[model samples]
Target: MDEMAHKYAHILVAVDGSDGAEVALNKAIESVKHSQGATLDILRVLDLNSLEYGGAGIALDGERIYKIEQANEDYMLKLKERLLKDNEIEHDALRVHLRFGNPKIVILDFQKEYQNDLIIVGSTGKNFIERLVVGSVASYIIRNANCDVLMARTAVNKSK
Candidate 1:
């Protein structure tokens, strides 16, 4: 007899070009492979507003923002191509989304629009101080997201 398989129709994974996010992406890819007819949605959220600066009013440098978006898009496109080539899956099975907003809020809010049954994220993408100041995205999701959340991690501290 074979054990029952859990088939997830829709899966969402957030990536930020970090080691933790890399692990999460790998897990998401594996999940899409095993679950027949499942679709993997990879999202990378950029906060251009955070780059804005002004003495009194909000100021955004269009040139800088454009450069960042262009670079980010290139990165996402390369990842998408590699995933398609390495996985041997249909092109439509994998979807890439780039949005501008607060990652912590936008990630969970995304489920409302796309209705992802499963959300996978890195254990801690931000550094120690950043996590302290802005808080961990994974922790926020675990507390707020109604759907199932998985924290993918790596043995980066195994040496100690």
Candidate 2:
């Protein structure tokens, strides 16, 4: 970031392995470039509440939970590595969080801890039925965040 202009010093991006998320990340990177030294937080939430463990009453086994958590950590590590290799972001400028909970609530609550000035999320990852039933994460974040929010859509490729 330039010394005097930093419209968004900190940005929070939520991803869910969707095409929209990929675009959102791309947009976040683009925004960070203009903001200069803005730090980014990438959050991925696993919906453990919907897990099927022998019906509904049975608890999810400890070992299974452990493995899932490990997988999430591995994915985060790979993401960090990819970002460091591809972007202008320094290793310390990017932070990844893999949390298990309702995405809407987790994302909303997470930004409070980071003092983020901007929040970027995919426009809609879920289909019509799912979104109708549970509501979309992007909609929730846009409505609830205390800071500026962006509902990122598909990427637009520019040619020279």
Enumerate residue pairs that collide in model 2: 1-36, 1-37
Query: In model 1, how large is the Cα lDDT of residue 38?
Result: 79
Tens digit per residue, CA lDDT, model 1, 47-106? 765654555366667887788899999989999999999996779989998989998899
lDDT of 2: 0.84
The candidate that achieves the highest TM-score relative to the unseen native structure: 2
TM-score for candidate 1, please give it: 0.85
Tens digits of per-residue lDDT for model 2 on 7-94?
A: 7888989888888898888888777766666788999898888778788887888898998889889998899898878888777778
lDDT of 2 at 59: 81
For model 1 the local lDDT of residue 94 reads 96
lDDT of 2 at 27: 82
